[model samples]
Target: MKTLKGIKTHPLVQRLQWVFNPVKYMETNVQEDRDIFKTTVTGKGGLIFVNSPEGIQELLTHDTKEFSAPGSVNGILRPLLGDQSVILLDGDRHKRQRKLLMPPFHGERMRNYGELIQKITRSAAAKWKPGQAFIARNTMQEITLAVILQAVFGIYEGSRYDELKQLITSLLAVTDSPVSSSLLFFTALQKDWGAWSPWGRFLRIRQKVDKLLFAEIEERRQNWDENRTDILSLMMAARDEDGQPMTDEELRDELLTLLFAGHETTATAMAWALYWVYREPKVYEKLIQELETLPENADPMTIFRLPYLTAVCNEALRIYPVGMLTFPRVVKEPTEFMGYQLEAGGVLVGCIYLLHHREDLYPEPKQFKPERFLERKFSPYEFCPFGAGVRQCIGMALAQFEMKLALAQILRDYDLTLLEKTPVKPARRGVTLSPVGGIKMMMNGKRTPSKSVAVPATV
Candidate 1:
């Protein structure tokens, strides 16, 4: 059997490239080897990066049997999401934690957040004037963070809520650059030089967040509210197979996971969707035509089912996926992948970036084309921005719902424009790729619905 193709560069160099300039690194490597490549940049040991849809499907579909999705492979995230976090657990523990957390993000519980999401968007959008310029990502971050706080802890408009929001935003901003992202990838650089130091600042902010989280957990434990449908309340009330409730640390870890993962990535996505919609005049006009088709009094779910809007969101995700790779899946037994021999513990990651950009899967992959999604359907594996299988993001449904509603609300009610004609480039924002300079834009004015559509009651 032939060995996997890879960059024959030094491991340290590859690691730095992977952490510092991951987009460039991935693009360069993909040009050299189209389908798969063996690399040593992700965490430790050897890792094979799979790009083809068939290969990605093969890996994700049989992940539980021939391969295993272990949380230990996600150690790079441990400093941010603690060991007990669901994202870092494996096997039965992972399954159980997911079950405990699943109820709040799916079904009726998730639907309740729709109105709140639209209200939060409108509330945030109200502050802007016709001439005022704003960073789309930062604004979106505020909306998403507020939405998560309300959905997760059922807290809004309080000192604790305000403080947590400020601290979390500050904490995430600390690692918004490529150089700063290295702090997470290289654990050795995580030093406590002082409170002002990069690592030191992260730790200080984290300590404050932890104190608040622990206090929240303790208070919730002492006074459990069965009536509340927020995620934290649901998690607090859940019992495992042993009929045991989660500990304070477990609750805190999971809360941080939900807070960080839920808001941060979605904010980036919303910003990108807005940027793309405004950037392309044809797209902007088409979206407006579709939005005007719905009555102004339409429910959030009705707005969500819009075809062209869904395609726009999907196209944005396809262009720059939030997560570059699936959580690394390990070989559970000896198996061959595309003629390459595998050991029981070999590591592999489906390169979501490469897969989404493949010309075969998406014609003219570099172009921003929403029509492709509307014209033809793509399989789950072919268009998985949230990953798939056992490791599929539990928040997928909520995130998509929030995106569609928030975008619909903003697009239908507000007129915004990119501040500059230059293109916005995607750069590393912590673990996810975000628009550089937060995709600066100016709010032109509020959009009035067509005369045919009755004005809806304001939330």
Candidate 2:
């Protein structure tokens, strides 16, 4: 098989580095070939990595025409999201699944989520006390998990919701360590020895989650409420071209997909945003100043449109994209990509990490400067935090809304200070790159009441 500019590292070393220190792996490879290259990182050999905007645009624009974005290429995710999940569907099925899932996260349907997001953020923030240090990521995770559960299941507070939340959190915690994360990569290690084993614990937690999910689904089926706006209710009402409702198994898989994808990635993104905002005093001051211009009780949409807040979120995503690569797009026929020649069956991934760090596109790329977003406008391909085109994140709008509203609420409602001055590096959190230590911080105290912003009545 032909190759792009190849990194010289041994395949075994590359694979281990990719799993253990993915940021280091990508940084080293980009130094060798900034635009495109090949690696054994995907558990498959000869996968091409393309980071340039031109390559990403071509790959995404012509997706399904010149190249096929097959979901089987995303098998790394299938162990978590099942065979029937939208993330694992291909061809017409992928398109149809995306359509069915898109409505709840778009336009007016998304606006309905704003007040709920702020309520969750405020409630979570209320739990923090002055002078007490805590992991910001955990705090953000708590807020995001609640938001997603409400949006996905429409269950605000209940024993089942609490159980589902606890089990999912525990299951995901298994991936916090390199050893446990490797279990997802090595299929043989997935065998269950007992509840004490890593895979065994994962299976057990997953089973409980499954039971809770099925019970919820069955109850909703027996007493379906058409007026409910949650994603689950929306999906329950939707039918495909064949005029068929999703099967219980299909609903379970899709619900799991939305739950996992919706909460985890957004939580990580918000955590990084909080870290950057506090770490850079100027950024923090400017952000608070912008946020304060609005009434303390500003609506979610009002906060979402704040210029500096948007830039802060954009910079955070650019600095360390949660998912480092787009789902692999395969070469449909013999063709040239960017400047390289490729044959049919070749796999391509838009290397989001490298693209964001391109020195030409972002001068002094490592620096967290929100002003870069303000100074210049970038094309969708150029500034894609979420991957572009056919397989772009279905929840892009909701994620952005959550990040902006939650950050705005936290900044206006309470004061926080980073406990560690040293830079926090990104580490592998399952498939996403998250802050290494979850961004530790101390809550100073609640901000004094001021005319700059008014406290929300609901809080």
Candidate 3:
């Protein structure tokens, strides 16, 4: 019989706060309505933000039936990912697209990328000399981008690869700040006034990226090879249930989606992991001891499965989840959730940030404690950094794999120091949350393999 509570602030002010300081906005609103609250953050029509584990489970578990995960609700990303991107597709089409794209990111296929990830991480880390300062996020971006380019597209070095990498970095840099990121949130500010304008620069850079993507798709189409195992090749060969291949447009959009989603989120995560590990000497020493247990030239999978290392990565993700909210799930029929009645067509998003910070789920949630993960196992809904359900991140496996392996490679090979004593707060980075100032650090020199005996694995 009760209706969802709505934030009393003006719609425009709420939207601005959501864009400018989303963490503050969510924390402020959650204080009023802990379980579920309605806000005009995405502009009017009442978007519900749910953080309670039971509420989230109810929303995501029944996403396919009781609630609909419509792509139209994700229109905000269309400009960057295109309408054909899987993130912007709903229903049967979305399901089909996911099926086709799922192969390369999971199973034994992921094992193949391990060596490549470590190699890329080492190569990037090699560039940092002792006492050299670098931004953790930028370095991680370089590593992730290279890993994706070669692992997903089979491009390591070439004019096309270089141009594509530079252009994509340039494109992302435009929205690096909240003020610049506003162009994506507010349609009114998305005006293209020329190359001098923010939106205009974004459009021009996007055009270049599209040109490169289309070119790559076209070249691959002309020189089709059945033996190619890269994601692009797999996508080109994949046929839908109707036996029709994806169109050039679809391929281009999906490629951009992978390139953006794959590198951007993973890089932010690795940077945060680096920050947490180095910032806490206890975490850093514990992780190093675990990493030293592996034999020289250890199998990437062995490194991947290290217990304390896994805990560190999990804790990092839990603390400041890269993606704040899951893609919106709309109510398909009248439903009652956590004693509140919701009408058909109600919009809902699982607020991952507040959920992870819940006092009940994670005691002392603000502290960076990797031991918590090792202490207790949480249900998917309770510890979902990668938003659960049908729309859960397709690259979830790869992101974690890359995060663990890359962190292992970096930590095991190099000693680094966190340059900032002050905490770096999470700030809006496009649609995801990233560490402000990107976590500055200085390389201390390469670490030699420890002669100490391997410690017993404890999970």
Write one digit per residue (lDDT tens) for candidate 3, span 1-459.
Answer: 897778999999999899889999999999988888999887768799999999999889887678999999988888889989999998899999998888888888888889989899989889998877889999999999998788887777899999988898888875688888888888888889999888888899999988887888888889888887788888889898899888989988898888878889999999999998887777877888888778889998898889899999999999999999988999999988888899998899999999999999999999999999889999999999888888999989999999999999988787677887688999998888999999889887877767552221111
Superposing all C-alpha atoms, what RMSD in Å does each candidate have to the true structure? 3.4, 3.4, 3.0
lDDT per residue (tens digit) for residues 1-459 in model 1: 866655789889998888777888899988877888888886446788999988889999886688888899888888888889999998899989988888787777767888889999999888888877888988898898988888887787788899998899888876678888888888889999999898899999999999988888887778877898788888898898889888888898998898778888999999999988887777887888899888877888888789999999999999999888987889988888888878788899999999999988898998899999999999978899999888888889889998999999998888677775578888887888888898878777877766443321111
Q: Score each candidate by Cα lDDT.
A: 0.85, 0.84, 0.88
- lDDT winner between 1 and 2, please give it: 1
Q: Tell me the spans in candidate 2 whose CA falls farther than 4 Å from its real position.
A: 1-5, 449-459
Candidate 2 C-alpha lDDT tens digits along 305-331: 889899999999999999888878889
RMSD of model 3 against the true structure:
3.0
Listed in order, each prediction's TM-score against the native is 0.95, 0.95, 0.96
Candidate with the greatest TM-score versus the true structure: 3
Q: Model 1 RMSD to the real structure?
A: 3.4
> How would you order the candidates by lDDT, starting with the best?
3, 1, 2
| Segments in model 3 whose C-alpha atoms lie over 4 Å from true places | 451-459
Among all candidates shown, the one with the greatest lDDT: 3
